[model samples]
Structures are given as structure tokens and as C-alpha cells.
Target: MAKRDWNRRTCAKRGHTTYAPSEPELRERLHVATAAGEAWRCLRCGDFALGAPHGGGPAAEAPPVLRGKALRDLFVLRLLAVERGLRGVLGVLAAWAVWKFSNSQDALHQLFDQDLTVFKPVADHFHWDLEHASVVDTIRKTFDYKHSTLVYVAGGVLAYSLIEAVEGVGLWLGRRWAEYLAVVATAAFLPLEGYELHEHASAVKIATTVVNVLAVLWILLSKRLFGLRGGVEAFEAERHSASLLEVEQAARAVPAADQAAV
Candidate 1:
């Protein structure tokens, strides 16, 4: 009776021959052999392990490659995240402006109503016109600085900012509900965006409208939202089929008898 070697026992249990060299040594050998256009032959099975350098049992499979629509969908999700993030930032700025204007109503009114005798002399020196009644009137009307109006605007902007932030986070995390929310929100703004374009056409306005429209369409069609294009079942099936683990298992499947024998 002799003390059983654990390493040999483990190898026996796995039904594979164990190499004496360490992993690093095996890797180096495999690397050199592969560069020379020769395969690293396995000791137990007498088969070329090709690129496998680590003990030559089974070659490590590469991660599942996302191609075609899967890759496009991921890119779209990131794009949506960026768009939502920008909207969130704009909402925050708007909210801040509302708060500042609301708090400075008295100061704003005083500055606008004060006499401009000294400022007129300075303006004349600089060849500036301080007597533009239309400009002054517009400024006064725009920044009436009503506390109630400011409060209401700030509340609206704050709520919108929260929604944008939530959509950004959810889209970034690739949540399904986030996709639906993004689609709905973006679609809701399309009509307003279109009307703005009709009122005042500009490159920025056109680009924004196009991007939002495309985003809405992509989410609806690609994600199979609202019972379109085979719905949720098909969408989930596509995701499962594209999974790395699933791909690897399918590619490396062996017969039951072969697995038992191994």
C-alpha cells in the first residue's frame, strides 16, 4: 500500500493526462510552437491542441462576438444614453436659471427701472445706443421676474430633469423599461420639434428633430415594442441566442457518451 498522489488522482478523475510543466511553462511552449506553424500535441489524446497553451485540454474559447443587429442595438442604447444625459443637463440649467431669477426679482426690477443718465454718457462715448426702447421693452417683458411664474417653471424643469436622469441611467444600464420610456418621451417631443422647425428652420433644429425621430423608430422596431415585429418573445429569443455562454455551449457540445467517457 502506497500513499496516493492527489495530482494523479485528480487527473484520473478528470480522465485526462496531467503535464509536469507549470501553466506558464506550458503557455510559453505553446506560444513558441504556434508561431512556428506547428500544433502543440496533447499527451493523452495524441491530438493537436492548436492554440491551446494551458495544459492542452480544451482551448479557451473566445468571448461571443456581437455582430449585425446586436451590435447596432448596443450602439443605439449608448447613443440614447448620451442624448438623455444632455437633456438632463439642459433641464438642470433651466431649473437653476428659474431659481436664480425667482430669488432676484427685486434686484432685477430695480436695475431695469433705474435712471440711465450716467450709463447714457458712457454709452455715447462708446458709440452705443442706450435709447433702444424696443430692446429695453423686450428685456422687461421677458424677465418680468414674477415669483409665482418662476416657481412653476422651476418645478416643471426639475421634474423633467428627473425624468431625463432616470432615462439616462436606465438606458445606460440597458433596461427594457428604459427603452420604452425613452421611446415615449422622444415621440412626445417630435410634434413640438417639428413645429419649431416649421417656425424657424436651422441646422441645429433639423439635426435634433432627425435624431429624436430616428431614436424613437429604432427603439420601437429593434426592441419589438408594442407588439411590433414579433414582440417581446422574439426580442428575448434574439438576446438569448446572442449570449456568449449559450454560443460557447452550443459550439462545444459533445455527445453524452463522450462526456461520460471523458
Candidate 2:
């Protein structure tokens, strides 16, 4: 009887429940335990891992190297660039949604509510006569006053918010993936931005185009995305050394040696 009771207790301790634990429950338990447990902390990121991916893996024993100011600056720039890129994308989406639900409003009317040949070059280049296009007619025909294009607008806002939020978080966490994503997303919209500038050539359009180009350049050149190893770090080290020397000199400077010694 004693041995049988002990076996049952042992089985219970070993997770021998009548029903299997759901994934979420198991995950929650693991998370709780990990949070309470002591583990190795990453020097660079301050993240803790339990013995790395594989037992005694290469990553488990490696020490985090010090990052230089250049690398840190690159990280910071990446964060800002991705955030701005997200905003740019959201701006496009918002514009698209507004156009979609405006009951086939003329692009010229939508652009600035002034009747001008600003879009003429675009129409000629694309052979798209917004004035008499069948697609425009169909859109107008299908339009209703009660129609709320708010759905598209809401979707665009939500998508933009979420994407930007993710990129922001990834950037804050120093993820390399976010930098690439920012670059790709920004590059994808260059053509559209160029077109917009060409269509209107307005101050706003020009500023938008310039900002996007600068952002791309910042991510590519300043951030040192996909550069050879140690290059960014070396730059950072030089910057840090210069700063340290400045600080040291400031510390050594005396205020007229208190005048008595002089």
C-alpha cells in the first residue's frame, strides 16, 4: 500500500494528469518559471536565456562585445527611420482610403480642390483620362450617398498603426530585421512618392519626396546596414575615445589654480 501510494504521488508529480495541459497553460507556466528563475544574462542586450538553444552551445559561452557610439547611433537612426517609414506608409494608406470612399471625386478636386492642369502630365504619360475613364464611371455609378468609405479608412489606419508599432518595437529592441524591413518598405514607396511629386510639384510633395530619399540614405549609409564586420564598431570606438578624451581634459582643467598657488 505504501509503495502504491508513492508511485501514484510520483506519477502526479511527473505531470500525469487525467487531461493534458493545453499549450497556452503550459506556456504560461513556463513563462512564470522563467521569470522567477535566475539565468545567464546577455551583456549586449541584457536578455536572459536558459543555456542557449542547444545545451552548452556556442552562443551560451560567448561574451557580448561592447558596442561603439557609431553602432549605437546607427541603432538609434534605424529606430527613427523605421518609425518615419511607418508614418509615410500610413500616410499613403490614409490618402488611398480617402480617395476610395469619396464617391469618385476627381483626383484634381481631391488634390487641392482647384481646377488646374496639374495632373495633365500624369494623364498624358499613363494615357489615363480621369475625366472619361469607364472605371471612374463605374465607380461613380456604384457610389451611394449613404456609403461610408470609413471601412477602408479605418482598415488603413489600423494597419498603419500596427505596422508602425511593430517596427518601433523591433527597432527599440535592436533587431537587425527591423532595419531591413524599414529599408524595403521605404524603397517600395519611392516610385509612388516620385509620381506624386511629378503630379503636383507642390511644396508638400517636394518635402515628402526629399524626406523619403533622405531616410533611405540615412538607413543605407549612416546606419551602415549590411556593412563589413568591425567597420561600424571601429567608427564607434573612435567616437567614444574622442568623447572620453574631451571629458578627461575638462576634468584636468583648473580654475586659475585658486590664484594662491599662481
Candidate 3:
């Protein structure tokens, strides 16, 4: 099996971002004459692309194109963003359901009673109790809650949903603040998730708890949040070093004629 080339895959998908550096050494190293035409090395995937450069500037002004682990991290963050967005959507639906139920409690309860009778025959066939089943009993108990309490519950769910949506948008855009928010928010919920898992050891509960735990750790440690792993300064230094390495590697492959021109 071939290892994935995230840099090249991203370049291929998004198109290469060729750059002409104003620095004498970098300019010479990246500029090349090919059979097709004059070409410049892409700052992103390090591939030589034929054409006029997309942009030209000092080395420091070159666009910060993601590559290697940075590109991989972007993928991970986007995936997490999608997950968060989905959870937010589900939460909103749950809140709406709760709110609607609170408003039509009596009618819904009557309808549920009818539905119970409809399902009673099937339950008898399976030797199960229709109304006494844990899930059914839980639903029945919700009907006993006060309207104000249900409204409060719905508001809480809506608030949580909005928070998740905000996290999704920020994470999708790769904001540092969003990473911090996600780490903090998810960490804060771990105890609740753990409590739920302890109360009901279902596969869904266990999986949710595990994913949240991993996500919190992954973001906090990988992102160096709250001064972990040498803090944000070291985190930034690593990325800067990676960028410099890309330039150096591209410079290393300069043709003799190009090298001589410098």
C-alpha cells in the first residue's frame, strides 16, 4: 500500500500555488526553464509548475501554504468540525421536539396511549411489555413534567446546540480561538458524559464519551492549549520551522544552471 501524500493531494485538489520569491537565492533556486515554458516551484506541494508565478514577494510574504503534518491536521480539524455541526443539528431537533411536546402534552399523551395499544399486539408476540419497557416508561415520564420545566430544558438544549454550531464554524475555519473553545467546552462536558455512561452503559453512550475524551486530548495536546507542550510559542515555532524546511528542500533541487545564476 502506498502512503498518502496529503500535500500533493491537496495541491492537486485546490491547484498549485506557485510563488516567486524576491530573495536572490530563493528566486534562483525556484525559477526554472522547462520544455513547456518558464516554471516556478509551488510553495505548497514543492512541484515545479509551468507558467508565470501566481504571486511574487519576499520569502516572508509568501503565502503560508499548508503541507505535510499541517495539511493532515487541517483534515482532522475539518472532520471534527463536521462532527460538531452534526451534533448541533441533532441537538436543535431534540430541543424543538421537546418544546413541541411541552406545548401539546395532553394531545400527545392521548395519542401515545393509542399508539401503545397499536404496539401491544406486537409486544405480546415478542413476549415484551409495551408500556412498561424502559424506553417507553422514560417517554411516559416526560409527559408528567411541568410545562415551565420542559421549556427550561428546551432552552438549555438550544443553548448547547448553538454553542456547538459556533465551535463547528470556528474549527472549520481553523481558528486558534476555536481550538481553545473546543478544548475547554468538551473538557467541561466530560464529567456529564462520564456520569451518563455510568448511569447507562450503552454502546452509544460509551462511544460518545470516548470520542469526546479523545477529541479533548487531541486538540489540547496537539494544539498546545493552555501552555501545554511548550505552549503556543513552541507550537508556532514548529510550524515556522516546517515552512523554512519546505523552502530549503525546494532550493536543494535547483538545477546546476539555475544554481550558477545565483
Candidate 4:
């Protein structure tokens, strides 16, 4: 039997006799049957094999890799974790500031009460004046934090900071419980945020409130919290169905009848 030149182009455009493989010939040669209207091109010359005898062999194509919702979920989780981490840091700073002020209350009061003459030389060296009564008043008002109040405030801030840190870690690890915790913690503060806005509205306060609200809503809805929107099963199914492998398989199967007809 003569050896068939599989690499040669069989299309008229390539100055060769047009040839297309029959179903059995294609299956024997390429190990896969070609569908009707599916043109096979020569691997070497990039020409279509004419007629039903042959066309193009399957190109060396890799299946699409699917990340789908998994990728999206990871991105969202990381973003939330970063936000929580930042909040945790701020809480820690606030707690530290309170504790420091509480311990140095006496020293700060004495410093404020002392005459400007005591620090005149240092102030002059730094090209600054320390003769303002308002500055002393401000310091006095700021340091008016009672020892008991400072202790309580610092304790609360420390606790809050720990919670934020835990939440951040859990979120970064993509824990489902962390999503719930975040939603509850954020929602619990909404009322306080509203009250703050009512008392003294500022751009920062408004922006913070809006961001928290959006984050809470996004987690609740997107994560399908509390069985919303067909629940976990549906969500998982959607993710699985949207996978690249599943999609590609579905696409490949569409021409099954056509291939059979050939």
C-alpha cells in the first residue's frame, strides 16, 4: 500500500488535488471523525483538504482552563481582607493612643501648666513661638480624659481591633463564617454611623458609612447568604456549569449529530 502524505496540502488553492476524508478514513487516520462543514487544514501547508475525503485535522489545541467564580470569589475575599486589616490597624493605633495618654496624663497637665519661659529657648531654636493660650486650652481639653474612661475606651478599642484582625485572617483564607461575621459586624455599626451623621455629618463619615453598607450588601447577595437566590446548591451549580471545561465540552458536543450525518 502507498503511504499517504498526511502533511501535504490537498486543497486546490495549494495547487494540489482537493481531497476530503471519508468518515472511516478520517477516523482511521486522525482517530476522530470530522463533522459536516468542519474544514480540516493541512498542518504543514495550512491548506484545507478538499472534498469529503479530507479537510483539516484537529489542531493541537488545549482545553480552556476554567477559574470562573472561584477566581472572582478569591479576589473579593482578598479585597475584603485588606479592608479589614486596615481597620484593625486603625483600631490598634487608637487603643495605643488612649493608653499612652492615660499613663502620661499628669506629665502632660504639668507641661501645659508650666510658664512659656521654661521652653522659650527650645521654641526659639526651632523658630517657633509657644505664647498661645489657645494651645494650652486645647491640650487641657484633650487630656481631660478620666483614667477610668481611658481604660474602658482603650479596652474596647483593643477588643474591636482583635475582632477585625481575626475577621481579616478568616477572610483572607476564604472562610464562609468570616463572610457572615463581616456582614453582622458591619451591620451592627450602621446605626452608630447613622447617629454620627445625624449629629455631625462629614464627608469622611458619609463615605465610610456608604462603603460599609455596600460591602455588607455585596457579601450578603453575592455569597448567597442566608439561602438567597437559590442557595448554595444553585450557586455551586452555576459555577460548575460556567467552567471552561464544561463549556468547551458542550460546544464540542453540538456537532455530534453533524459528524454522525457525515
Model 3 segments more than 4 A misplaced? 121-128, 244-246, 249-262
Quote the positional error of residue 188 for candidate 2 in Å. 0.5
Over 63-116, each residue of candidate 4 has an lDDT whose tens digit, in order, gives 322243554666688898998999999999999998998999999777766755
Which residue pairs show backbone clashes in model 3?
A: none
| Model 3: ten consecutive residues of lowest lDDT | 244-253
RMSD for each of the candidates? 13.5, 20.2, 4.1, 14.2
Q: Against the correct fold, how does model 3 do in TM-score?
A: 0.88
What TM-score goes with each of the models? 0.64, 0.39, 0.88, 0.60
lDDT of 1: 0.69
- After superposition, which runs of candidate 2 have C-alpha atoms over 4 Å from their true positions? 1-66, 71-75, 78-150, 222-262
Candidate 1 residues lying further than 4 Å off, grouped into runs, are 1-68, 112-136, 248-262
**Model 4: residue 61 alpha-carbon error in angstroms:** 25
Question: TM-score of the candidate numbered 4?
Answer: 0.60
- After TM-score superposition, the amount by which residue 84's alpha carbon in candidate 3 deviates from its true location, in angstroms, is 0.5
Q: What Cα-based lDDT does every candidate model obtain?
A: 0.69, 0.52, 0.87, 0.69
Tens-place lDDT digits, model 3, residues 117-147: 9989999999997768999999889889999
Encode model 2's per-residue lDDT on 1-262: one tens digit a residue. Answer: 4323322333334422111122332222222226546343322222344442212212213222323343455456655756565775776677566657565544534553233257657877898886677865655553433335545655666666566666666666656677677677768879988887777689877887787677767666654666633556754545454332223233444443555577
The Cα error of candidate 2 at residue 200, in Å, is 1.5
Error of 1 at 105 (Å): 1.4
